[model samples]
Target: MMTILIPATVAAVLGGFALRIWYRRWKQQRIEANRKVEAPNSYYSSRGVRQQEDRERWHSIKVGTLHPLNREEVLRLLDVVDEDGVSSLSRKDRLFLDNMTLPRMGV
Candidate 1:
């Protein structure tokens, strides 16, 4: 009984360690692959995201009206910054984000 318990415990510990290492390596590989895929796409993320669902409602609004970035767009932009770093933003996207940082009126 003692020998069985000891081996079982050792196996569990070793298995946990092996799983941890494999998971770390797997995560690194997946992240590298995603970065490679997204490298070219990082630019398109800022300006060309087509909000088809939202656009249906916005169609009534005049084209020239200054539309604020909606909640999801803000979150996606933040995710882009988190993933790719600040330098990833185009000048226009950077300025747009900069303007977003300003204090709002009557809040």
Candidate 2:
């Protein structure tokens, strides 16, 4: 009787554990099934607007058709950097500095 009772108790505990695991997996699957997936381009829809504009401007500058910034423009940019620190500049401002200081790749 004692031997039979021990085995029965062990089997009951294991059965309960297995049932619990199955219920949790079922719950997770239901949650996943009900979840709404975002469109691939949705992430970029509103994000990076400024970065995109900066890239377009940089590309235009790199085309080399635009004349180099005049002396006054350069001075104004420098003064802003000097007074407020470099981080105060906008993306366009920073890109202008990049274009002026960095050597042209081919020429």
Candidate 3:
């Protein structure tokens, strides 16, 4: 009886220790995951800078005004559309295309 009790008691203590270690590790992993989720990626940070510059350029242009682009400028935009889908164009680029096409549409 004494021998059986001693081994069972030892196993319970060891199991408690094991559970404690596993719980601590799980908690640490959760913290690390949260940090990763919260962290700002450098790629996105740089993209944001580019986007801000585009916004500033967009603001400088007058609305409801026809701003004609040079041949190279027009080709550059077309090349961008061909390389990357139309969805890749910024709001200002889309507006430029819209204004340019409006006259051709006979509207």
Candidate 4:
């Protein structure tokens, strides 16, 4: 009876652990499957209200408007963040980067 109980208990614990791991992987896959993305047909036109908004956005990002975080400065800031996490940034650096817009790729 003792020998039988030991083997059964071992099997039950191992089976439960395997089931837990499987369940976590399944949950992650389910979350990934349900993730949201922008619609392909979504469109914005540069006219009327949109035109004015774009102008304002451009003005807001204009030099002398922000704290002198140019494209090169922003790139260096990103490199620092990559090397030593966001927490390593100075308060001023964090404020500057957080408020600045992401640069256009291939620019």
Candidate 5:
């Protein structure tokens, strides 16, 4: 009876340890697979194109060729100032124009 009990107890303990190791490996593999699935669609891929477009748009606005304060424009000059910065306006007159027209446009 004692011999049988000792062998059975040892076997149970070894089986428990094996199960724990297997569970850990399975969990690690699942996490890695999830990361692979989710990582590619993130903003990392389009960052360069988005940045380039933003730079060109800002340059056009700064040079006055792309004035947002124009009569049929969707965004006002103040919207540009708020999204970009006041330093992008280049002159006090442009800043005053933005301040004046933005309120009239209900921006």
Candidate 6:
């Protein structure tokens, strides 16, 4: 029984060591592969940066009036305005729309 236990313990220790070595090698290989894959010109490169800047410039020009509605007020307004006409909308709906939409139009 003692002999069996000694060999079993030795086997477990060796198996754990083997697994650790295998994992280390696997991790190193993965890192090398990632480096090789990312060696080409990435989005952080100069040309990519220039392209991103150009996109931002175009977006600034084309950006129309976008009202930043508060989530709570927007939900409240949605609740007040049903499928009926604007006349059915509550005072809260009108106020919510006025507060949100006017500033965004640069009014």
What lDDT does each candidate get?
0.56, 0.64, 0.62, 0.65, 0.56, 0.55
Comparison by TM-score, 4 against 5, better one? 5
- Residues 21-43, candidate 4, lDDT per residue (tens digit)? 99999999999999998765446
Residues 1-107, candidate 2: write the lDDT tens digits. Answer: 99999999999999999999999999999999999988774534443564444334433433343345544565676677657655578978876656755453333
Q: What is the C-alpha RMSD of each candidate to the true structure, in Å?
A: 16.4, 9.6, 11.2, 15.4, 9.3, 15.8
Candidate number achieving the greatest TM-score relative to the actual structure: 5
**For residues 12-103, could you state the per-residue lDDT of candidate 6 as single tens digits?**
99999999999999999999888845556454557556434433332243113443345555544444443443455556655545554323
- What TM-score goes with each of the models? 0.35, 0.37, 0.34, 0.39, 0.45, 0.35
Q: Who is ahead in TM-score, 1 or 5?
A: 5
List where candidate 4 sits over 4 angstroms from the true fold. Answer: 39-107
Q: Is candidate 3 or candidate 5 better by lDDT?
A: 3
lDDT of 5 by residue, 1-107 (tens): 99999999999999999999999999999998888454654545465564454434433444344455452242454466568764465565364554433232112
| Number of the candidate with higher TM-score, 1 or 4 | 4
Comparing 3 and 4 by lDDT, which wins? 4
lDDT of 4: 0.65
User: Model 3 — which ten-residue stretch has the worst lDDT?
Assistant: 98-107
Off by over 4 Å in 1: 36-107
Ranking by TM-score: 5, 4, 2, 6, 1, 3
Of 2 and 6, the candidate ahead on lDDT is: 2
Better of 2 and 5 by lDDT: 2
**Per-residue alpha-carbon lDDT of candidate 3 for residues 10-51, written as tens digits (9 for 90 to 100):** 999999999999999999999988884535633344665754
